[model samples]
Target: MSRFELLVRGGTLVVPYVGTIRADLAVAGGRVAAIGLDIPVSDAATVLDATGKLVFPGAVDAHFHLGIYRPLSVDAAEETRSSLVGGATTVLSYFRTGQHYLNKTGPYETIFPEVLSSVAGHAWTDYGFHLAPMDTAQVREVPSLVEQSGVSSFKYYMFYKGFNLSADSRDAKAFTMSDEYDLGHLYQLMEAVAEAGRSADRRVSLSLHCEQAELMRLFIDRVRADGDPQTLKAYSDARPPLTERVAIGEATTLARATGCAVNLLHLSSGEALAAAREARAAMPGVDMRFEVTLHHLCLSYDELDGLGAKVNPPIRSHADTEALWDGILDGTIGWVASDHACCLEAEKGDELWPALPGFGGTALLYPILLSEGMHKRGLSPTRVAELVSANPARAYGLDGRKGNLLVGYDADLTIVDPDLEQEVTTDLLLSGQDHCPFEGRKVRGWPVATVLRGRIAYQNGQVVGSPTGQFVAR
Candidate 1:
């Protein structure tokens, strides 16, 4: 028997907050056992020769929707399989008691367990959930959710207050199926999370989807009334950056008031990023972190051709994309995520108004950052590692166990061929979704292998085995 179960030899390890270094990584019992020079290849049972590749921590894709459109078990199987291609070993997906997911409303005591049961055996990556407390009853569950269920994070959709954008209806109840999911409910949720944080040693935080509902109602009405263009630009106009700014103010004000740590999720526009920065400056004492998504950083309504690129807090102009990249380069943005919701083409049809928002980009996580961010924008490999991996792990309470390629951490890493370039296609991503929003674009820095818990989950552009992914406590 060998001392190490697996060894990745001759690679440059990109460690977040610490720069890159040449090292041989050894794994034992699913945790990183050693990282140093001259670990003989014969000592390991399995060895992967990574002579010239860059090895990075497997990304913790913080924003995901495992079952938003499809059934829980199915998304668990297919979406997570897609995650492997992206070099994400762990995924923290969002769940809510609403119309699309499970299509029913109930206390998480029952619903959460059922959700867990449905996805338990189907996933191909370690997973956790960031639940939305849609009603007061669910808000009451926050304490137990944090302590017992190991759910350190919660969510509140700022735009789901009084409107249902999905159905183009004013009644949010038509979609949320909850009781008055407005600012008041958000306050209670924050209060619960804040209070819960007092007891837990780890962070107990709330994530807000910051798009104001009333503003959306007004703009949507105006857009529809003024000869709706039926383009991505029209979608962007309907739900402009103004909504994000106002919602940031509303959410951050409450975050400051309740003393709750908050994450401003998927800030889509330059205006939105500016508002978040202003809020951070004003409330220096509050713990607020900002996030940008891959689509927001690269794709814009002007550049993207079809409705497949349509997403909530709609993809902005090229200026907004550059602004977000500025945020990333300047340290204003801590992390980037895919905001991956596996919506198929049939769901996203020809009509922009009724088409579902969001498409899968998880598989392009490393590829895009490496291609555009590093290769074009001069983003350092170390910062790229932090943006995709470490920062997200710290934000959502998976830091010590999952983020770095250090001794005693989970041996979750990806070996990348930094020079390998390939065009984006639905077939390449291995997702269940039939069409890809980012097709035809060329990307470099492809991951040759992705290891989850010291086991090779994906290698040589193929998934390695059956679903061995386990549920992460936090």
Candidate 2:
């Protein structure tokens, strides 16, 4: 038999398509070399006894925002480490040009290098980027970004037209995407993206942040006018389920008109899923895909009050959460992500009415979901792998390469003690943000050892390897 670099001894390798069984997974040159029982370890360079562990393919987080929430140089590396601990071996973060990233100027030509520089050698696992087109210049640069930056995925923020380019200090209400002229320009950019995608055999998928801007502005006005702080449901009542439904319909219509593939981000309500279903059924060429966050699956609008759960489109009702769970089991929901945007406690506590749109939950995702999703909810372990790893990889074109435990796949794997129990604690987390909404929440199943490219990057509670995470060129 051929010699191997490392051998994972005596674990039941759980490949989704292939049934689970006892096997020894061998690795060399960062790819799976062999799998069978009782491989003699005398010839191997290193060995891991995964005797009682559920060895799973490392997760591929399809949606992540590296530099947007904070600086890439300072925050991206740290955040990537948090992802590593949670078993995400590969992360696809979205970046846009302008002030929020670094207060920079010029097109992507000027902005791309600075973004790359900030994240150099700072991740424990591999990484990729998705660029959001904010202007005509970026729309034109899509093909080059795909070829050079290896970014095949792009984003379209429906509600942040003018606000996207402006700094946070500026009055966002004054420069919203609802400005009629800018909305038209945004559609033009979308059309350009559609055309660009045609040439690249792999259709460049556009991720849409679907929220109707005008309706949101109107609802916020009515809510503040009513001025009831205790009505935690007010946030959801304001950005009602209909709002997401409307935007989803608009996104699919645009996709059909332009011949582009659309992927809706962080959909929280039942109405939104219904719209996506309608689009797929109606539009012949429109490849419409949508996803819901793990937080949405596990939490609801009533559990933590409005602000704590005040994510965009909101946490929604119990009915909506149940619908999301159903979608996960049925496979209509493409993937499950963290949608983790960590805002400081002080920052998140700015106002009672409308502080900001998000909160941090990166470290809490896996344990919370595994505990609640599998243990409490009775979802099969097979379903967990599909939602967390396999489906996300396939959706983003990183399938066999990153999501599955197959020969020729990257040696990115997670070792989880399936029966381990733990409570969510901010102190133990590796995130740059200090607090999480899920603190004190208990969950079963935890990843103890995370391997990235055959290197032990995160084990127990500490990062073991250098942040030499390569820029994965898709």
Candidate 3:
């Protein structure tokens, strides 16, 4: 038998927190075995020449939504294929017992297993889930879910308390399965996370969607009555930054009291970013991390094409976009993610109010960062690696094996050719969803290949190998 399974030779490796170095990486048994110059080709089964390419640890996308808007099996196959093409080898998606996702109200004891079984053999990349307890019964299952299910993170949707997807409804109970998503329930959820952390083998975190429901409802009514319902600005005006700010304050306060680690997801506005900073200062001991989405970083409301850019916590102005970049530069933002939901074009109608929020961008994950952060903004390759790979791995409890380009870690990597430039188009994307909000835009830097567990899964904008992904236990 060969001593090494594969060798990636003559590449510029982007090591997190360390400067880039030219090295040859050896892989055996699906993990990085060695890193040095001129490993003997006789010892490996295959050699891939990576000359003139930038080799980065494959991105760990921490905030993905696969089965939420579509079938889990289909979403896993298609979206993860797109994610791999974009250089993400592993995806940690959020799943909950809700009206849209599993479409049931019950204990996770039955539901989570069904969720796991549904995507058992379908994904093209390694995958895990962060679950939300939508009711009291599900909340009581947190400890077991952590210990047995290998789920170390939980979610709280702050805007689902009494809000509706459309402007006409008054109650969110049918959607969330409970009327208890208020502050008291949030406190209890934090307490449960704290309790789980005491015995969990890894860190446990509570990820929150921090938009205040009552405030959003009021604003939505006013916007519907007074504003143009067809424009992206109207959506932004409806769920303004103050709503996110208030909810951030409330979440961090409860987190400080419960001593639970908290992650603020998809922060989109200047006011929200400022409030997140204040919350961190107020609770210096509480573990808190912030995430920004690709849409927030790349496009603002004034620049959007249509209602397809309408996401929850809607995109803000140019000033807010600048604020997000500042946060990323100053190290206040821990990571950037796609918040990728494969909402179809038909679902996103011309009308803004009824249009479904969220569109897939997993295929643009690394390209956008490479274009804006490295080519345009002067961010170093090291910082870009951390923003996409290392920070998210550390934040979401995947640091043991998923993040860095170190020996004994999974040999998951993406090779990018910085000189390759391409325009964003729907046909170029591998996602099942047909429309891209960023269509026709040009971006520099692109992924040339992706490796998962020493197997080449994507190369030259195509999926090259069979699905070799497994459930990643935290």
The candidate that wins on lDDT is 1
**Model 1 ranges with Cα > 4 A deviation:** 164-177
Candidates 1 and 2 compared by TM-score, better number: 1
Against the correct fold, how does model 1 do in TM-score? Answer: 0.98
Give the winner by TM-score. Answer: 1
Residue pairs clashing in model 1 are none
* Residue ranges of candidate 3 with Cα displaced over 4 Å: 164-167, 170-177
Q: Model 3, 134-159: lDDT tens per residue?
A: 77778899999888888999999998
Report residue 264 deviation for candidate 1 (angstroms): 0.4
Residues 1-474, candidate 2: write the lDDT tens digits: 448887888777768666577888988898888887799998578888888988888888777778765778666677778887688888888777654666564688778887887898776668888887766767788788876777788887776643432443222322333233255655776677677677765547788888776676677667767864544477777777787888887778877777777789988888888877777888867777878887787777667663555577677788888888877767788888887666666655635553655666666556755787778788766677777788777767676588888889998888878888877787667887777777777788888888888877888988885786888877
lDDT of 1 by residue, 1-474 (tens): 999999999999999999999999999999999998979998999999899999999999999999999999999899989889989999999999867889888899999999999999899899999999888888899999998897999998888777644655532232453557888889988999999999888888999999987888899889988898878898899889999999999999999999999999999999999999999999999999999999998898778869888788798999999999999999999899999999989987787777888899999999999999999999999999999999999999898998888899999999999999999999999899999878999998899999999999999889998988898998
Quality of model 2 by C-alpha lDDT? 0.74
Q: What is the C-alpha RMSD of each candidate to the true structure, in Å?
A: 1.6, 2.8, 1.7
Q: Arrange candidates by lDDT, highest first: which order? A: 1, 3, 2
